[model samples]
Target chain A: MNPIANRYTELVGIDHPIVQEGLGPFRTPKLAAAVSNAGGLGTVSMPGMPTDLDAGARTFREHIEECAALTDRPFAVNIPVGVDNNGVVLPFTDIYIRTVLDARRVDQSLAAQLTVLTTSAGFPGDYIGMIKDAGLIHQHKVGSTRHAVKAAEAGVDVIIAAGFEMGGHAPSKAVHSYVLLPNVTEAVDVPVLLTGGVRDARGLASALAMGADGVAMGTRFIASSANSDWHPTYIQAILDAKEGDDVAFDGVYGPCRGLKNAASLKLLNHQEDGTGEVIDAVELTRWKIESMQRAQTTGDVTDGLVLTGQVAAAIDDIIDIAHFVPNMAAGAAEILRGLASALPDTEHAFS
Target chain B: MNPIANRYTELVGIDHPIVQEGLGPFRTPKLAAAVSNAGGLGTVSMPGMPTDLDAGARTFREHIEECAALTDRPFAVNIPVGVDNNGVVLPFTDIYIRTVLDARRVDQSLAAQLTVLTTSAGFPGDYIGMIKDAGLIHQHKVGSTRHAVKAAEAGVDVIIAAGFEMGGHAPSKAVHSYVLLPNVTEAVDVPVLLTGGVRDARGLASALAMGADGVAMGTRFIASSANSDWHPTYIQAILDAKEGDDVAFDGVYGPCRGLKNAASLKLLNHQEDGTGEVIDAVELTRWKIESMQRAQTTGDVTDGLVLTGQVAAAIDDIIDIAHFVPNMAAGAAEILRGLASALPDTEHAFS
Candidate 1:
């Protein structure tokens, strides 16, 4: 048994203290199920999901069923509330609440598999009560300690402390994980999951050492074969990426970090909401989702916003998802053992 | 006996894989000595050292003697070249060369104790020859991997990689430690010491886990008994500081991170360099040094630019310098031990 177990694994009933965070609309289904099957909880993301609510709900239901069919292990469904889908302000909260209720009505076992519901992009204020009522283990992503505290106060089951290094739509506060994780972990009683800049077992071990209960990795997972759904060229981009290749840009929602490509540069130059974007009030929601899909589906790597983190610099290989998390955990264990043995002798010598 | 020994300890003859980075002008002597005696290398800093060359040299000599008297262990002297102190463009490179030669002339044993000469703030090409001729270990600080590679190419013995969260003058690249460290560590063959956002043993352990040979800390040491030379009120301000209290300002050198006190806020609003600096290149160089000193010795935390880092959020109490590094290293060891036991079992269970 990996000694890396923590409150996160116990709370979510997983074997490992790692989480695959939700990507934008259409990032999971197969990938999410693969992560869950590997003993670490996987997440199916639909941030600003479904341009058409009813049709999107049907798709969401189908995706949930597909993941359930693939893995018996626990998984999560990510819904970024308060995002505008172009001119249509997506009723993401309502869709999320209804999706949970409807999934349970359709199949209780499938509903049970969704051990957690993760929200990001905007304040989950109006939807907390409804989320709790749906009996979902709620996890809210925050970029600063203040936001984490607010989420905890509002009764979020877990706080995901994401730093400025995170890809996709990040918290606007720009607090880094190294500083923000400890502050959030100390400020809240709930288990804190460190997000952003984590790639392997070393990162996992480091997070555990720094008061985080676990870690949530997005970019690392994106580089694996499990994420075959994402463009192969995109994965290659990540493997080839170096420091400074990833940059922050104002997308349709808010601050997004990704490997610099043609789409992101255009987004950066766009006039509007790069600074104080109310993700929910944005009218270009549909365009944003489609752009990511274009990036994901288009064989071309530079066409869509390829969301990623700075940790992309460290990713050099793509592996099977089943082997990815386990191998990383083992490598981290070896390093820890060496340090443990080495540290004691040094301590004694000093004493 | 300490298994934690690395190239850093071997290079400098210290017991622990930790370094006390030179804080800006007016730091060290006692602090440096305390750190060296505690088994980690300590550094006496001199950035924009003194406008008065003669008096500055006397004071510098006196401080070095004091450190030698306090501990026979190896310590370091830091000189940041290309800085203007008041109306004087301090001949820092010249002063550093003369100081090293003079120190050797005065007392050969004292010269032996000065095991390392660290440089930062500007290109070190001109002074590398003098450093090499003196037979002292050479270390250079950099904010980016490109700079690290450059310094490594220059044949520096070590590279001190700093992240954006570091206090005093920081890298203008703004790349963070999590991203920058691995890039630099992978890009260069020389030993790398991580700086910024590290406050305790956990940070030290984390740095080692991430390819760094050792760790360096400045802000963490600032809130310590060893740093009594810094105003009590300024230290108190760090203890009392809430998240977001620190801000980045373009001071004399480049970007500087410090607590946002009245002086800092005024600087923020000023013209070119903030504080109405005009940034005319000439008019502002002198103003930056005085502002920092005013903040350092005035006993008024609000009046001076109180240099600090994001780690200030993690610091809750002051400590004795002698005990600070050792206790931190031990604490880190204990954490690593627990993880080692915990991780191996999990890996075996999964495997």
Candidate 2:
């Protein structure tokens, strides 16, 4: 394999500067392993609060083990810094984090494989050292430049700067990709990966041009053949998706974007102002986030939410997971080469 | 000069694939000519409603004549189709369109230089024929894919797809640049130019990757030195701007983005119910749009509105207007070359 060098690739030891986003609350072991084998940093997203702390840890451990068994390549696990609406820490976060950190301690095979930890949602300051101490790269995702600066200050190894267009739990600040990407990349010293509204090679190439070292895509991965374990109709929902198919859901700390359907519409319609008689907003938010995963399993487009980014509108066809990253890498490579070939003969370089 | 071939450049007869946005509601004769002369399409934004219909037409004609006097290169004029809150068409739109069309007929020398008419705010279907019959190129700017299809069906020569992040009058739909751009470009067959949130060569390169033929920047142009005719402090304001400094003003059909100064704050806070108000909301919106010009002339940063896009937050320094397009061109060229040189040999390229 030809090594395309970048800070993100070097830091994570990946062949391509692409990260598979943590899609929904699922143990996507096959999907993650498929991406990693194809030379991209595949990430297994921590599933929603399991029956209990033990179940949550067991689920995370199973995912890590399953992915390790499938591929010899390095992979990462995403654990959102679980925090409630009231800024209080939630349960199951520690259980999940320890599962990834101690998985190598439990099994030597997975130790070298699960080498990276990506934390999102809440602040990473308290956990950055813990992650680093475990001998893993800590990459934190942020929604705004202020949050990015905060994440960088916390001594995170890398920053995944997400825009408002991302599916699942997105940044509270509604800053778009092009606007937020350059800002965070310019502000922080850490290598930045762009997320949200990115679907293909052009999106990846555009991220590199925007000063991001790599890209982390969630919606694109959902449409991949490797994720065929999900309902075929769910994948079909993504392909049949058109512009403006996504809507916002008040989940966790902020709004999460996903395909608008009966489930999502119900979330939108629940515009509670707390004036009504006794409503658990935070619990309801958590339930809403958890319910989204049902869409893929139940194959119900209306009752369950199909979490995807605004980029879903542009995705006309589905590609096999085997070709996804390589295709994106090669397309970006060709685009850059094409642009290079078109360069004018000149000594003048812009500062 | 090496010609960067694109539909936007070829259609508009510009060397580089860049278009300077029509700024504010005043005569920008010097600004328009300088960009056009510098091998990019410079646009003269139609001045706001004059004292009367005769005065409005006269001011537009004068601005067109002045732009023609400054450069032999082609330039365009932007006429926003003003629509009120109650779905009423505001006055002075027809007069302005006629003025642009008849100006060339009034003075044959002005005909070739003022070649394009870009209609925004409302539908262009009503006046597309009049301009086409006048033998002028019709380029309309729309905020969404639906509007782009409508404009294309209206027989316009080009589609300038503007995103929600744009300054001044923006679409009611809050679709972002990457989302709106690819959507419109895919939906319509016409040549598309991405507007809003573009600052430098990276932004232009990203737009090209997203399938846009070119980029039109309003906030970036405001920070240029060639625009020295405006107050220095105004440029300084743009330089000092940070992310989220720009916000939406509920003017006309949608929000008008600008620096969140005293004037914009007042507009936002003026959330009228239209219950018992004797004032016309349409006239109020028009006045708000017109009053934005005072920021350049009066230099009252607090009281007058400063129209700029989200990209303003990233701009730190100013360059001469002469170097703007060339700088962007060279920077994009270098970036493309750099990416090309860094590419690894691969057998994969996405179809």
Candidate 3:
């Protein structure tokens, strides 16, 4: 028996409700397969926005195929919907969503393996219908209760409540998890996953207590042993981060959380809400993506932006995913049962 | 036996581990007594510092006596430790601590009723010795794991982990509850109570799951029906708040969370980390405190600063403390038990 399985696990066909959420602008094929092998839902991330849309789509397909080869368990792909200020969907978002749908059409085994499509950053507008028609569980991440309600009303299967403390590309509303999670859960009937400030079993149990069906973590998964695909220095930076060492900077999307290094300070110091300078907007976007990739590809902790969650301070060790995932769920189950049994029967005093 | 009794409730001699934490710079004697009478630890707030230190002390003593008279159950007094830039204890902090100690020394009944002392803002430093010597349970509020460890090492009986989302004067570190609470619980042996972003039974259960002994709330208590001492408009403003309405500005202490009104904008637009202009430091400090008091006394929520936590968005109705406190604890225990029992048995699947 999976000690913490619920509707979320049953819907996703995973043994545990835990998920290694998308850590985009970086690669996570190996990390995704490792978590899936451990009986938790894993996710393949969207690579950085390269100049060629077709090349970006090819890279995404390779990552999915690589993950399917490693584990037979079902997994997911995260595509952050990029919308322009004029509300028009960006070219990359259009290309990536279609890439996944077309790839699944060509191969039946790949279609079965990649059963979930997760969207973040912006509202997936009409893409929700396409994903649902493609026989994929649609999970849309939101930072506000209003958005959660709107998404649920629009037939989204799941909602991932993204808090301000979440890693790369946080909610523009800046709502913390403790205050936002319950509001999202209450607003939507579909399963809700809390995405921010979660590190271990205690966090998973706390998420359940706050009315979330499960937890979707990014930083914790980034610091695990299965993330050997990432540079050692990137993982070390996360382990070495202390409280207040992280800051939110203007990312390609909205505000992004990362270590307080030289590269992030450069972004925070300039840019006066798009009023300071009339430089190349496209160039600036590419630079941000390149800096993030540089950190992961080459171990440059100082100049490269190390996107991480606030929970990075609490994480010191690199965990082995296979053992850590199941142990975490089991531990959370034990804690909940233990606390219930330990309640002192002072009912008469309360009356 | 209480449904949620633990080291914290046992230490404070309260039926439940819930605490209506300090909402200082405002009178809360009636509100404090109502919570204490309802079986949770209630806290009498420190009155604003008038020009006369002696007068302020007299007012604070009266508030404590009023709370003691209203409730035979044990209660607490919240006195913020104010220290100057040079690290000298401010006159107001010194006077208020002495007033609580003197009141307890003279009247044995008052001493028995006011058993707990909570100190926030600055570190208690040498005053820890005085509080312990006076036979009061010393619970210091901290915003980081390092400070929690320091307070626990200095003989504090309990630690209230104040998150960045807390109302009034928040921690300088700005750590959120989910990220900081577990870190504090792991760093120290002292029973930790999570402060900030907590409202109902779900928050209480989440706190336990995160390893905290209990939860302390300021914004949740401020919106209660017992807080009639506050202007009805102030409570209504909190009720009307939606997400992203609250902002952290330059407060008397490091930072403060409150509604985004005209009063808070005045502070945020000016003052460049004490380097922009020659701000009459004392005058600015007095004006800030006066504005906070003005909102509480008068129903000027728009013009006067309305201090509140981000959790205000989640709270819509005023609750009766007599029914809310103990029932919240019971509800949390039920939720914990329900979640544990709902876990599906799939251990063989993981193996």
Best by lDDT: 3
lDDT of 3 at A17: 85
Clashing pairs in 2: none
Candidate 3 docks with a DockQ of 0.67
Alpha-carbon interface RMSD for all candidates, in angstroms: 3.5, 3.0, 2.2
Q: List model 3 lDDT by residue over A85-159, tens digit each.
A: 899999999999999999999999999989999999899989999999999999999999999999999999999
Ranked by lDDT from best down, the candidates are 3, 2, 1
Comparing 1 with 3 on DockQ, the higher-scoring candidate is: 3
DockQ of all candidate complexes: 0.42, 0.45, 0.67
Least accurate 10 contiguous residues by lDDT in model 2 chain A: A342-351
lDDT of 2 by residue, B1-351 (tens): 643555667777888888888774855888889888888888998777665779877878788888889999999999888656675566778888888877888877788888888888888666889888998888888877888998898798888888888888888766778778878877889898889889888888788767778888888887777776688777888899887788877765578888888888777766433233355865776667556777877676788888888778888888677777877876776676666666655223311
Which has the better TM-score: candidate 2, or candidate 3? Answer: 3
Which 10-residue window of candidate 3 chain A scores lowest in summed lDDT?
A270-279
Report the lDDT tens digits of candidate 2 across residue range A79-168.
888776676666777778877877778777787889999999888667789998989999999888998998888789899999888888
Model 1 CAPRI rating: acceptable
Q: In candidate 3, how many Å is residue A192 off?
A: 0.7
Worst 10 residues of 1 chain A by lDDT: A272-281
Clashes of 1: 18
Query: After aligning candidate 2 to the native by TM-score, how far in Å is the CA of B294 from where it should be?
Result: 4.1
